[model samples]
Target: MTTDQSSPISPYLTFDKKEWAKLRAETPMTLDARDLERLSGVIERVSEQEVIEVYLPLSRLLNFYVGASQALHAATSRFLGQSENKTPFIIGIAGSVAVGKSTTARVLQALLSRWTNSPRVDLVPTDGFLLPNAVLEERGIMNRKGFPESFDTRALLHFLAEVKAGRPQVKAPVYSHFHYDVLPDKTITVDRPDILIVEGLNLLQPAKLPSNGEAIPFVSDFFDFSIYIDADPELIGQWYVERFMRLRKTAFRDPAAYFYRYSKLSDDEAQATARHIWETINLANLKANILPTRQRARLILEKVQDHTVQTVHLRKI
Candidate 1:
């Protein structure tokens, strides 16, 4: 992406490949991960090394918001209820799959924790609230995983409410990426923190189409701030397909892996299947649900094909 000279932001990103070199000067550092190379079977380059330069500024920016949110929370709590302690500031992060939102959330957690005023930033992924495989299978929606309807919405809302209400400790469900399912009997706890970040694909989606007149609240209502990672649909699809094909050659090869059955396919055939899944499942979900919620974000990080953030679109308050 090339910088828009007209735009106020420095090194404004535009749709030009040559601009990347010029914009590299604006980036601070890059994350180094040999592990990403080992894990990804399809990727030719481990540009996760780009993470530092790409996300460090983002983390610094988010730390500012986290502090502001906490200050606002304290003011509101005092104004409404004189003696009550304020809860942590909650930030919601939403984006389509393979857009790197998970990695973003983790990096934010690490960076936000380094802030002097707020050294504690807790991250919770909505994957934990996904319905068990049995339930999805029973409902014949096993193929619709990551869709808004596949989660335990009420339970997720309840957990967020408790966290917002200043509960000393809160427990959240946990999910396993390897198993591709929400784990049973395993949970993560959040002792009151300075900030809480909730990440998921459908986190910013509006409530389901109404049936009757009354509307039910969703977890996003608890967010003090929200972020949406923006990307072109074609780019996201390509990334997803690339990741899937890579995983097939590695993770799927593990005999005990849930997707092990698909590992036997030839590379060419596996790549074709990955593309098919992206078109039929992921791309459909992005259009039907996620893309529509971009307007809901307080800030949007727009990325290009090179896996670097090009522009940051912030909502005018």
Candidate 2:
């Protein structure tokens, strides 16, 4: 005899995306508008009702999880009878490029910081861990930039180790989107944050040592919780093109922008360039690496082509 104990939870029983939209529309807007504006860097024009319905409950859920994680940590410390140390509650957010992981991380950091305990929340991106273009060229990996092998894995791992050990003034390298490169010697010192949200394309990667035979744990090993943003490939591709079109009129016009050449391109020319990048780089990385790691996430937020979340898939117990 065997037993089966797993099934979907939530009132979600429909395949239609409108179900969420309708539900969100019906819910009263309780979350303050100013609250959201201050919490998020990118003030996306999401409907007020959606926050009241969907995100408010989600925020409450995450708060509970964070509190539980802290309680568990304290219990472990008591068992060891060690001196009190504050280890930041680390969360890993993993998703494909252009899948809104950055947006999600920013929103969560802002909301979590405003909770009753009002812990200090810091958001960091793993793009800063990317090797310099010069270094990538030296290793002949300039073309395969966002792949797992392109990162300084050991350095990233060590940084997380020190942060988890509650070391004071832990510094992380900074990456600039305008420059499209890691800023040399510029570091963000994290001073004992109550929560650290690490957002990246490949944070859920599995550890694999070379045939040279060494064993090493992955960065995901340090995460107390992890979430994977999910969306269809076609939707992400469209969003990439749209975002590129928007940037063509904004950042691309800057003389120092890495994409300054795009500022001069016609609309069609810019779209073509964006398509080429999606096909050659971002999409390829998504299919080959990022999508596979969804299996490792503790929770998955599945989205529809309209970019609103449809349903959430929690890992089976």
Candidate 3:
């Protein structure tokens, strides 16, 4: 581990991939190729080597954090002279559109679940909280679909509040990628799990404060721990185009797909369309909203052009 030479008082301790891997320290690998295949995204690759090096140490660290949090909660309960309900440990994963937040969250959920105690872990994506297409169209902001404003932040907060309060059968709406919309009748029941992982593009976005110091609970206020996936914007753009092309061959070929119109485009046309969308929407969103919150994360996983994490900058205790 190393500290930034430029900022003598920097809050983070930096670790190269090799240095971070050493921290795995006897943490056994629990995932196979099949598990990786299931957890990864269209272009995101989660190899066994990544699991052994990057995620194992992260799992061990999170395990320790969870244990400590539980102990602290227990102590607080004791001080109050009563037993309190178990509060789920919530982790937030934030990054750009193609930054593989889902892959990372799913991998963590799997590893965390396989711990000796086998705690119940739930994974939820904020895509479910995205405003419906009709709503977006009505608001005349359909082009800003993944922007922070596109989300039903109030509903998201309510869901998190209920989950944190140990409510049973808390329902979160589901989003279908094929339809590119929130399913009206579909919901995921989150039953007071031991852990919940919330993944999104803007999970760490801060709320604007009032002059009178009013409490405005932002989405990240509910997170006990947070991670930011970092990579070059250019590389991410390339990956986005690559993923779009792949989807054109697969999902876009289905007539029911929201982006089915792009399926018939020639290679050049498809590439141009992908690039246009990336530049006009995704890239703009990243620069204005997502990238700004990178420093807010408890841990930052900086990825190389190849999409594997090359370094980790962890906020110090």
lDDT digits (tens) for residues 258-291 of candidate 3: 9999999999999999999999999999999999
TM-score of each: 0.83, 0.87, 0.98
Order by TM-score, highest first: 3, 2, 1
Looking at model 1, the pairs that clash are 2-14, 3-12, 29-52, 29-53, 30-52, 30-53, 31-52
Query: Which model scores highest in TM-score?
Result: 3
Q: What lDDT score goes with residue 305 in model 2?
A: 71
Q: By summed lDDT, which 10 consecutive residues of candidate 1 come out lowest?
A: 12-21
User: Could you report the Cα RMSD, in angstroms, for every candidate shown?
Assistant: 4.9, 4.6, 1.0
* lDDT (Cα, 0-100) at 228 in candidate 2: 91
Misplaced by over 4 Å in model 1 are 1-54, 84-86, 208-215
Stretches of candidate 2 exceeding 4 Å from the true structure: 1-31, 34-44, 209-215
> How far in Å is the alpha carbon of 107 misplaced in model 2?
0.7
TM-score of 2: 0.87
Considering lDDT, which of the candidate structures 1 and 2 is the better prediction for this target? 2
The runs of at least 3 residues in candidate 3 whose Cα sits more than 4 Å from the true structure, single-residue gaps closed, are none
TM-score (C-alpha, index-matched) for candidate 1: 0.83
- Colliding residue pairs in candidate 3: none
